[model samples]
Target: MSGHSHWANIQHKKGAADNKRGKVFSKLARYIMIAAKNGGGDPAMNLPLRYAIEKARSVSMPKDNIERAVKKGCGENGGVTFDEIAYEGFGPGGSAIFVDILTDNRSRTNGEVRKIFEKGGGNMGGPGCTAHMFDRKGLLQVPALAVDEDALMELALEAGADDVERLGDLFEIRCDPTAFQAVRDALAKANLSTTMAEMTRLPKDPMDVDAEMGRKIIRLLEALDDHDDVQSVYTNAKVTEEMMGS
Candidate 1:
């Protein structure tokens, strides 16, 4: 765990993601709506809806809120339509930043994101700028002490994971995006708990940066993530726990 793994763990410990629960719920609702509208309101028939519902439920989102979003998506309740967009850019030390966005107002979000990048010591780029540098995959985070490494690896690999990596006190399980749910179900059957699980873009090349530059890169990531429309942000800047003051 160097860039994303380290940063995610640190953020989890800091309660950074949970601190903005209201914003999280709203973003998740948008995710559900889009998934439902694209496919159908039934999770059994819609894979994306199932994933979205699971994520919302993971965060303890109210059942009524989820139902209403489903209704809105199915045209029972009027609501704003959102577009899925990806923003690619460069942060301090030439580190790559990839942002996943869901928004009803593209023009407004575009302007705000550009300013965020500039203010955080970075610059926004056109499509395929930094996006080509990453591969979309499923990543699962687990504490080292939670399970035996060899046993966990065997189970994950048997269930379709590409590999299991041991990084300090953390374990990262990487798998093909399509196999994510299978691997997750396998772990659950074995009574294992994961701290974080998501399909994300992983950097092809991790960039080494000094502490000062790393700090700048993280600030840019934080700012982008704080935005209402930004759902997720990925980076390639390599920094240590001590350097990030984790």
Candidate 2:
């Protein structure tokens, strides 16, 4: 139902500018380990672990690496603990930004994140600042060329999805977080493949920006995402490749 597509940001993130594959893998492993530790390694019984594993596989994380992380988290190896934190802020164009973080030392990570925000022309805010601008939901992105629209709509809706609509070249299936598994399972069973699937936050009001503002917002978001402790970055701004000026 939304006109703004997150596909542009998704495309930007696929760039290898400064994101080394090893560092990306390490971050995903942390996610997997924490999920497996909190809940058992069984993805069926553990929704968080299922999401973590799905993210890992999306990045092509090795099977051996994923199994090792699960074992490590299950206490087969020494247990390491991490704290989950959410950082909120406003970008150059007043776009709301939300960052997910996983860190062992909150103080250090906080300082680092704040510095990144500042250097990128933004300021990190206290709790509940930017969070109110977004809604947590399940987003499954399927390429338009992949499946028939009516079929996807029927299958997704029957599986408890809230809505299904074409966003640019992709069909986005939206659902409540609780229904994500059911919807995902339904798609899997029907052999309908997705380009991307995840539990994510969608902006309540999509931010519109000029080319200059779009460049600044995208830079700030990319900087936040590249941090070692940062897990994910979400923004309300709709930035296209053309807006990322040099």
Model 1: CA > 4 A from native:
1-4, 10-21, 240-246
Task: Enumerate residue pairs that collide in model 2.
Answer: none
lDDT for position 203 in model 1: 77
The worst-scoring run of ten residues by lDDT in candidate 2 lies at 11-20
Residues 210-245 of candidate 1 have per-residue lDDT tens digits of 888887788788788889898888887775556654
Candidate 1, pairs of clashing residues = none
lDDT tens readout by residue for model 2, 126-186: 9999999888888887889888999999999999999999977889888999999899999
- TM-score for model 2? 0.92
| Estimated TM-score for each candidate | 0.90, 0.92
